[model samples]
Target: MTTPPHHPARRNLLRVAAAGAVSAAGLAAATPAWGRTTAAPASPPPGLSDPVQRGDLVVDVRDHGAVGDGVADDTAAIQAALDEGRGRTVYIPPGTYPVSTMLTVFGGTTVLATATTVIRRTDGPSIVGNGVLGDMTATGFDGESDIVIQGGVWDVNASNVALNGNGFSFSHGRNIRVYDVRVRDVQGWHAMELNAVETVRVVNCRFEGFSDPQGNRQYSEAVHMDYAGGPGHFTLFGAPDFYGCKDVEVSGCYAGPSADFPSYPRLVGSHGGPDGHQHTGLRVVSNYADQCTEWAVRLYDWLDGVVQGNQIVGGGGGIQIGPAGVQTGGNVVVSGNTLRGLAGVQEAAGRPPDAAICVGRLNNARTHRLTVADNVVEGVAMEGISVYRTDGCVVSGNVVEDCEGAGIRLHDAPRAVVTSNAVARTGGESIVVADASNAALVAQNRADDATAAGVRVTGTVAEVVVRGNVVRGDAAYGIAIGAGATGTWHTGNDLRGGYTTGPVDDQGSGSLTDPAGVA
Candidate 1:
């Protein structure tokens, strides 16, 4: 193996050429006509001794003796190109390059391939395709920088390879961008695991075909926004230290079934660190997720996050948010999304069932200032949008229809405002404020054709103001208050065509006001 000359910085060649264009104009203007008609052979073009010439800025994998014939190894040759092509672009042409071992990617390198390029994994043990080679110690975020793996189809070949590993696994990197890539058939582990990094973006990618090889860990994500929280949190083969991810964006991706296998169980989410050591500025937006065994998006513990504008279908559940800092669930926003056909297949033991969007892990009152607004939900197996154990939250401006349970329910949530929403054709109540949800304001909502009451204030609650709602169509009771409720005020509700039984069935003795004559 002959080494090239010790020259670098091919990335600066474009700016250097632009600068030289101005300099050449100035020089030609100053020098009076030393010009022959042939222009003196172009002055040999700059960087005469550089290892990477301008014409060879894109180093092809074939140049390093890689026969991408699908039968040859091509591992050593492609790896040779990668090791020497650091700070440059290694272009893999359209072919199937199978490897029996793992390939390592260095920092400041770009592994670019055509749309027809498929890097398939041969039979191997613990092989992660095109991952980092070194610097994976216990210290977090100390590994690499300026890495880009874009535009290829990375096939894990899960049926042949039983040892569980990811398609692309890297840790402790910053300024990483993975764009326009597709990963298929990852077994047991995630398709892409980016752990403990800062400032990353995964855009316009597709994750297809994931299954658990050992029949365990059936709920792995396609794109896991993980952190270095000790042994299993990272993809490296050892114990990593405690660090978290911050300023991450995973947008415009698709996570679902492949051509042959099922979709990844958890599409895109994070099972984050402890309460105090939390991640920040995470966004899972504008993606399509389906057929997940767990929640499509789970914000376990993060700060200042946004799960917005996603289209989810046929998942176990929709977006779920838990604690981030101390007891606080972080200042998060869940809005402008469409969720349908959720069943909550793998919900935790004491949690509610099949809510399209759930705001808490349980009846947790420490998550404050959360917002769930402007979403659309239909064909849900249970509740449409539910929150529990929160404080000062707002559930507003949503359209929920054809739910098996309540459209919107608040459990053990205090100081919540459920306003300007619409619920229709529910199997149970349209809206429910129960489980000691105190200081709630349920106003200006439109409920229609529920099997149970339009609005029900049950359990042990206090200071729940139900005002100015329009409950239309027929139900068991228009607004039924359970006997265990207290301080429930109802005023200015229009229940003209509602309630097959009666208009307002107020059984609680601690009630304050009633609907204005049910006319």
Candidate 2:
């Protein structure tokens, strides 16, 4: 007999919540559905004990009729473990098990494959969580809490693979870990997709070879999060992809060569919405990126995150703070990173063209309280740090060199502070504040060997403080404050080595003089 249709309202409610579509009122309205539904049986199946302890049942995929050969299908041997009906660790010995289907596990379960245990798929997503329901069917398993997939290779050749999240109609799963694995050659979408998963840790893993067909031009990201495409409203989808997913850490991992689209290959990345609500609470530390067409790290709807000590080289942009049309605020600290070889459109042969970093505003929304400090940026095509339409952001203690454009460009910003930064050998202006206004501060920054002015301030900037900066060997003026600019204070700066002062037309009541100890 068919399983009675699980309560439609309740199922839809769960699906909506997982997808982050439910509103506050909708959530409250659906509460009764949850309360009224009879809970699933808590007891274990026959010959199974409650609170299924580890080491109780040991199943070897090889012994349980798995072929163990690199070319043989191992779906049956793998299913035997899941069918046993208890929490246990299924061990896969050192052999390549080729499978076309997705392998899923129940709650309180661990799938332990040795480093040499290779689960290769001729198709896509060798192992998956059966949380969401869709066509091109794969395995479905529940009990996500305390689930661990460690020490093996999950090769995905498919284009679209959806994992945990409310949008996938999953629930309350926590502490899922994927460690010490290699994921390669995903022919479809995101190699790894983490949806509303909490306390998830992915460490010591390698993700590579993301390729797509010509003209498809799809967006596949290596690791993506957020709630998208479910029955609920957008607000019900909850915080942005990484929001509310607390203490999520991605360390010691490598992601690169994100695929383009059309040939139906994987390797693209895109956010799910335009609502200014999602946020990312990510700690991307000690990771390495190279030759990724997209950004090395794309922070969408992010807030209060830390991106530090990461080595990012050769990409479209090393790190993109926020995409367009999102509200990103609160303590995004980027520090102690090394960025090099950011080639832009016109690079010499054999050199990639990209930017070191691009900090963009989301939908004209003001991003505030950003602290970018102590980073070394070298050989970038564009500005080392480019802030667009942001406020209350600070860039300090950074060393930028050999950039084709301005070392630091602040556009349409207010209440921004740039201090103690060393900008050198730039083909463009060393520091450019274009058309920015109101309470901006540029202090104690050094500009040397700039092809353009050391600092170029244009338009009407009110109450802008330019203090204690050193400008030397600039091709143009040491400080160029355009006509009609007003209310700028320039004090305690040392201008030397062929740098001359430009006309300072003070339109408003702002003083330009030296103050003691301004450095």
Candidate 3:
């Protein structure tokens, strides 16, 4: 919940919006009040045995007294069909069914339908959830497996209402697949709340429409990867479980606003992890996120994840990796993403300070062994790539331009290698090695038309080497070293183009420079 003071984030930020009010962070946007008070079953009911006694592989909802009309309440009929269709496919024909109650998903549940089969919910909890509460044991997550919920449009029509209702909430399961499902208009909550689950794949789904709840819910995610750490957390009410997500993949998905609703505040991330636990094997790739309030993808306290090939536009930030709510976890690779116009999204939400790609929370959180490479960040208001408090990071082969702040900045990060980057038209310095960033290397970079210097090293930093970099256009200087900065070496740099000030302003202590090639 902490960030660099320059990058104003969604911990406790209050900003205006183009659609509605921008709420605060940590909204606690769980499901309805009934989900909070209902005593969840410890296990599946005894009657939920193999329902194929009638010698059928599929159960149709129309045969179970479900009128396909939009006025009839099809809650009981759908539940009856699903209850009888365990270990089978429960099919619903093309129609609009008004569901007013929560539907339970069994272990072997496979609910299939066409794209026209819509389950429009009223003011209620999640439309579908597993009917099991957690026991907080070591073997709690080994409960359910082999479930599939696919090929339908679930509209959680939360317009003009002040309730917290999600689209689908799954918990304590394994090998779950939720693909080809379109969840629409999820007001005040996440489209899918995955709690303590493992091996979940959310593919080719369209999560449309996510607005704030009645209270503060600005940081609400569309697909929330949550921990089942009991109540007062991201779980759907009283689930006395304790496990994080493992092997989750959210790819080829669309996370933006619906035609009738506003965009969600966030998408595809986690925030409620507090113990020494770590979510591992998370892969977020090839998603198109347009015009969100805060960020498109954010992972906190995560270990071994890859966020690549995502196209993000118009959010407060882009992909951010850090250690929040826990200590010592972030070994992530963020690469090949395209982030553009983040300033437009952040200013529309009334806070425009975060970078296109951010690593580590602040100067205090320490992330280890990160790789940020080959990303294209453009038209952002703040820094292009901002890394703070990380150890042994590599920022290479990136293309950054048209940023209001530095193209690439490292703060309190040690042993970082920044190489082979291309930067142009930056308002601040093109590359900055400052704020106690020791033992770093900035080499073979191409910088052009920076309003500030080409390369700047400030604060109490030591052993920073800026070598073999090509500085072009009229910057303030080729290399500017501030006071109190010790042991900086700028060698083999080509500063052929002129600047406002002279090239290599050496004002630091124990700084060495190569002979200038041009004045």
On lDDT, the leading prediction is 3
**lDDT tens digits, residue span 352-456, model 2:** 343465666335665667888999999877767877767788889999999988898787778888999999999888887766646678889999988878877
Quantify all predictions' global Cα lDDT against the true fold: 0.76, 0.60, 0.77
* TM-score for all models, in order of appearance: 0.85, 0.76, 0.85
Arranged by lDDT, best first: 3, 1, 2
The candidate with the higher lDDT, 1 or 3, is: 3
For model 2, what is the C-alpha lDDT against the true structure? 0.60
Worst 10-residue lDDT window, candidate 3: 10-19
Candidate 1 C-alpha lDDT tens digits along 1-519: 011112223233333334334444554454445321122212221333212212234556776777666788888888898888777777676677887777877778777765777888875532343344433553556576667777778888887776776787767767777778998988888888867778777888999988675777866888887767765566453236657788888888889988878888887877667645577898888999978777888876778998899999996878888774344666889999999887765456665575789877543426767899999999988788988788889999999999998999998888899999999999899999987788799999999998889999998887788889999888988898888887788888888854679999998766777565222
The TM-score, computed over Cα atoms with residue i paired to residue i, of candidate 1 is 0.85
* Worst window of 10 by summed lDDT in candidate 1: 1-10
TM value for model 2: 0.76
